[model samples]
Target: MTLGEKICRLRKARGLSQGDLADTLGVSRQSVSKWETDSSVPDLDKLVALSRRFGVTLDELVCGEGDAEKEHEPEPLPAAQPQGRQVLGGVLLAVGLLGLLLFTLLWGLEGLLLGLMFLLPFLLCGVLCLKVRRRLGLWCAWAVYLPQQVYWTMATGITWRLVLTTPHFTREMNYFRLFIGWVMLAALVALTVATARSFSGLRKEPTPKMVGVTAVLWAAALLIWRLRALFFGLFADETGLIQLPGLVTGLLQGACAAGQTAALAAAITLTLALLRGRQKQTPG
Candidate 1:
């Protein structure tokens, strides 16, 4: 079939008169008739518009020989932006690895340098995750840092006091591990809430009081955990390096302690984000 014949067939199948299709496209009915009669072709822009309006690919609409399999198939979106994000993520990860090597060489046998090596990548990944808007970028950032979180959660949570107090523990007394885990958990919760709101198409404004209360809870809990650890450190054996458990065990323990706070804060923050997203979706 010719392009003209295909257009006529599709238009009739959609139950649209030439005048109706032309009206939908903001063009003259005579132009539609002319195209159906093989008088002239639509401009490129018009062709795209027609393709969209008729739910057909540009190929299917412009040429009668469009494949049946390709007719309703949506074209794959361009990956230019995602490719750039991946490159950036790769560079950041490499820098982190380089930092680790340097730290290891400079501070041999003193796990402090190795600790810094572990931290740099997580910090970099967190920054990139927050800065990049694309899902691919966010996930890439997470992938780089996720292992660290798992390691910390397993190390610290299984025996919170061990990772928090030991000289061989993360140099920051488990603080870095806690902080990174919380950040990642928060992002996950926010993403979840945003997705839920998008699908439901509902918006709800979170009160400032709610945010303030959550902050207060977070601060108070953090302060108390730190103080408790300090007092415990004073009484415990100070010389030996405690063997901390793996990532799974540690995170479970951490979740039992301060992990809940981070998770809760994440849920609240995500809910607020979802509310805002839904509001934007609404017509002004």
Candidate 2:
């Protein structure tokens, strides 16, 4: 291939637009366009910058030598085969049916309601994992699932308040709860790291937009958590209704949980999109 073709290929392989490449190279977009069209070649200094940016040697970039095609082609994404899809569908269907049966047998209406509440996030995670089709997807699935499960468990009466206040609670049970909480927290941290690594591999850098969004989200979550009682009291008094604090607290908790879940999900999706975009750039 000509130098222009090689530059074009490398630029596309990195999932960068001409403007993006130009910005990185500290050149005008027209200069990049000229280079790709063979209208003008990069100066020696610009060539060095290009080589470094694309992780190629100066020899490879200037001489049009080496595995330029292979290096420029992105890794292929793993596609879900027909058999795999069928098996996955069957498993999901069976699990849903079994869950329904169990709910019917156990607590009837209340069980069904609780089961739906608990299952929604898991179902969403499963769908996202299938759509992402990457190791990062599995990590994100757990990230979404763990917090939702913890919230549901706590909502079912194993709250921190109860654990802290109840003297009759068994020491063993408290330890068990603490262990579970720690495990969930550790899993979340691990998943976050894994997701960041995967994103870096695909995009070669962490996205400032996503980092900013995540920070905003977590800040909001922490703020909400800290001022939860204040919000509850405000809403309770505004309604002029008795026994409304519990309702307000529940609503606020759900909203905060939802905000937190959305933040994590958005971060995960952004990373997955980066990987997917790189994979899609691979030649068929």
Candidate 3:
């Protein structure tokens, strides 16, 4: 291959766009583009920088010499965590679950579910460690899901308020409640199924079908949630009048849930677009 051709290939292999390469080498993006298109050659210093950055020797970079060691390199292993990491993850998750159970026991098995909202951060870490085999996009979903969950839990705990059992109940109100409940439940189930399929034993990543189902369910939930605010509004005062702050918080939570689902779907789509699986990068 020509010098410029080699630069182009290496740049692509490293997932570097022209702009990315340019920024790294302190040059204009146009220069990088030119080099890639063989319109111009990088200088000696620029070549050396490229060589180091791309993990290629000067001989390989300049003369297109194949690295004998790299030619016979092993194929990437499945994207699985190490046994020790898995054990550590299991321990962390066990601690969180047991702590939650302890809170359940201490809080009378009913009232203090929210009291252990303090464990949110630790549980989040545990989840990350335990599901380390999951695609990168899944974590974005978790990020979106956690904060609203924390807020909702803490708010309910502080006010000692339950979302259900209204004195001013109507048939429409009941239907609305059921709809929201079902949609949220279904969305959660879909997401869980998707997550379960992300493991190496079942699948390397979630199927597109699962992602589509999840996105649709979450979107439906979001739409129903907004409709609730439009018809009944989210907040209530002592006299059952609409309250602005409550409505705002309610809408914010709904939006957050939907956004989280969208982020997950988008992230996974990007990952799927790649030609290869998520593997530990060899020193190529």
Candidate 4:
């Protein structure tokens, strides 16, 4: 089908007449009729508005449904993902990888955790830059880093004693670290899912349902985290437990969970995207 046919079909599917669409798009009824007859195309902004108003993706709105599969662009990388952000992400990835490599070569095995602690920001920023279309690299960078800092602090809780005149171990910080660790973990997971969804060729708008769903997911993640003691106690021994503090263990758990969630979300995203591609190829 031509673009005009697709637009007319979509407009009718949404129960809109030429005048209705024209009014919605701030154009004359004649202009809408011209677009429907393929005399002329809507401008870019109108095209975007039409897609939004019809609740269809721009890809579906613009691309002919009956076109040959291979005729479509491969990857959609250049158009979907901007070049400058990809380059910036690549640079950050290089910096992070080289930084970790240099640290490892100089300090050998002892500095691995230290390397992770310090290098997470750049590495995360790089990954987010490459993955997300939005410029959320900085927010994504901090969401994980701030919690890691708390992790690092508790890992060296020896500092708490070192700074104080009278050194004493306390449970005060345990709750704080555990709760805040999960908060950041939930935020990171939500961001990971959002980032995965971006590959669907549509933007996600925030809604009350979204907020409520997020809150529920956060609760689930927190519940899983709350049982970390039992989970760790089963597999971990005293010698091993002594070496890595509870806060550090919590952070590691969060990291592993985040990685797994990212992988799963990405897998689902790839599957949906492939399905959409197949739909676009299939003739109606």
Candidate 5:
């Protein structure tokens, strides 16, 4: 191909219009148009900038026989067997050590069920990030379900307190809280099961809109929870359980937060799907 043809070809392949290329190289759009159409040529300085921007040698860009095809090919694989297992072992050991350090440092937080309330979700998210398969998300979601189960298991202490404090209503309210906890557990399980078969389909690919929307939804949910907790705290009885109405509202609020977080993650994956679809539409 001629010089102009080569410039046009590389520019299009890089998904840049004449204006985009010109802007990158500090030249006018008309100059790029002239170069592509063979009406004019760039000087040595601009030519060098063009070579760097297009990722081609001057010979390839100008003389048109500079082995551009070979330059664009993927690098050759190494001859030796890779140390994949050793690397993976090192990573795991490092993570284990880090966890030990954190556990030791946060001594005061030990044995608090509310501690798992914070740790479990982040651990689940980290696991979800590391694995590509939907099984990763499913397993993480399932593990967090344990916390909801154990919330009631430890509720025995609270149950005792309620019984001693208010014997008449103790049984009913304790059962009610347990029932709400069970419902949350069931919701996580159902969502996990539904997403498990389709998790691999939701690979994390970065995009502006997806990140923005997920961030906004998360912020909004957090704000709503904060307002509910702050403003509604005044209505709580001496036990601070907010009585029946507040207790039910708090339970529903927590369920909504869980659903919102899940929905945010799902929305991100759906945005990635849409982006991939657009990519498939573009021709080489």
Candidate 6:
């Protein structure tokens, strides 16, 4: 292959457009285009930069003597082995459907509602088992988990008034539920990290900017969660005391859960970016 062909192939392999490559090389897209078309050649300094960017030696880049064409040939991707995950996904889907049917028959509308709430996560889990790329499935699954209390109240025909006024809604029960919420939050973070690492491309170190963004997102989320009491104060009664209605609190709590999930997602993204950056810096 000619030098221009080599540059073209290398740029494509890195998933860069002429504009992107130009930005990195501190040159115009036209320059890169000209280089790729052999209408012009990069100077020695630019050549060195190109070699470094593509992780190729100067000799190999210029002389095309390193079996460059053969080395850069696209390899066939292995076929997916879907038997195990597909079977697991199918089983979970069946269980969710079965539960929906059973509950609808036994408890009528209320049971159906409850079953549907429960079914969402199981169905998503099944999708996750089938296709790892469906990260939104995991998010949907977790979203259902976040509003469990709201769903419980609705299913049991319990009013917000009863929850607030009744003595049975003890502080201890609230604490227990808070603890569970934290546990779920931790699980979400862990799952997000695991999912990011599972993808081969995300296993590299991240850039400093990415790390900063992650830190900022986490800090913002924590700040918001900590200021929940202040926010509740906004909905206070005439006495200037915080007095949240049950449904409002439930909605706020669900929003908090979603925010926490988003923060964890940002953290996962930073982790992957950091890994990619580290890999780039490391010697092969």
The estimated TM-scores of all candidates read 0.32, 0.50, 0.35, 0.42, 0.26, 0.46
lDDT of 5 at 109: 44
lDDT of 6 by residue, 110-181 (tens): 688668666866776777777653344555455455445345433342222233333455685564544444
> Which 10-residue window of candidate 6 scores lowest in summed lDDT?
157-166
Alpha carbon deviation, residue 236, candidate 1 (Å): 4.6
Estimate, for each residue in 142-216, the C-alpha lDDT of model 3 and write its tens digit. Answer: 554555444543343211112334455568655555454444445555665566445322212234765665566
RMSD of 5: 16.7
lDDT per model, in order?
Answer: 0.57, 0.60, 0.56, 0.61, 0.56, 0.65
- Over 106-154, each residue of candidate 2 has an lDDT whose tens digit, in order, gives 9987677556555555555445544433353555466465556445443
- Ranking of predictions according to lDDT: 6, 4, 2, 1, 5, 3
How far off is residue 93 in model 1, in Å? 0.9
The candidate that achieves the highest TM-score relative to the unseen native structure: 2
- Residue 103 in candidate 2 has what lDDT? 81
Candidate 1 differs from the real structure by a C-alpha RMSD in angstroms, to one decimal, of: 15.5
Q: Candidate 2, after superposition: displacement of residue 80 in Å?
A: 5.6
Tens-digit lDDT track for model 4 on 1-284? 88888788777765567876765665568888998899999989889998888766678778743333423334454465567778988998898899899889989864665676777778888888877654375456554545464444446432111223323425665555455545555655566566555455522223465445545554544454346456666766666553466555656565544433443444454445445545655698
Which model, 2 or 5, shows the larger TM-score? Answer: 2
For all predictions, the C-alpha RMSD in Å is 15.5, 9.3, 15.3, 13.4, 16.7, 9.5
Query: Is 1 or 4 the stronger prediction by TM-score?
Result: 4
Better candidate by TM-score, 4 or 6: 6
lDDT of 5 at 279: 62
Clashing pairs in 1: 153-250, 153-251, 154-246, 154-247, 154-250, 154-251, 157-250, 157-254, 158-250
Model with the higher TM-score, candidate 3 or 4: 4
Clashes within 3 Å, all models in order: 9, 0, 0, 0, 0, 10
Candidate 3's TM-score: 0.35
Model 3: residue 246 alpha-carbon error in angstroms: 12
| Candidate 3 Cα errors over 4 Å, as ranges | 1-65, 71-84, 133-145, 152-225, 231-284
